[model samples]
Target: MNLNLRHAIIQNVASNTKEELEDTIIDAIRSQEEKMLPGLGVLFEVIWQNANEDEKEEMLSNLKDGLQKQ
Candidate 1:
């Protein structure tokens, strides 16, 4: 069966408030499960698409810092 995973994920969380979204993201990260990566990627995609240039720069910087910790 063909499934639109990205669309399905977006639809599933579309009605969530900011706090709920934050909790979902935090939980997904803390779970440390490979299955959650796609959901986090989707959330990052949404954030990137809506972010301004400065915000994007900040995100990139934060990502770089995060990677450096490993």
Candidate 2:
């Protein structure tokens, strides 16, 4: 079977409002389910692609801090 997971995920949430998107992200993180990782990754990819250099740096710093907490 052929599947475009990223495209599918993007399409699934394309119409969501900001609040709905926030809820989805929070739910996915709280669930901590393996199946949700790809969705989160796709979301992050979207964010990364759209972010400015300063925003990207902030994200990288946040990620670094998060990893250090582990």
* Among all candidates shown, the one with the greatest TM-score: 2
Q: Estimate the TM-score of every prediction.
A: 0.91, 0.93
The 10-residue segment of model 1 with minimum total lDDT is 1-10
Candidate lDDT (C-alpha), each = 0.92, 0.93
**Per-residue alpha-carbon lDDT of candidate 1 for residues 1-70, written as tens digits (9 for 90 to 100):** 1248988889999999999999999999899999999888888999999999999999999999999999
Evaluate residue 63 in candidate 2 and report its C-alpha lDDT on the 0 to 100 scale: 96
lDDT of 1 at 19: 97
Candidate 2 per-residue lDDT, tens place, 1-70, comes to 1259888999999999999999999999999999999998998989999999999999999999999999
Off by over 4 Å in 2: 1-3
* Candidate 2: 10-residue stretch with minimal lDDT: 1-10
What would the TM-score be for candidate 1 when compared with the true structure? 0.91
Return the lDDT, model 2, position 14.
93
Candidate 1, overall lDDT?
0.92
Tell me which residue pairs clash in candidate 2: none
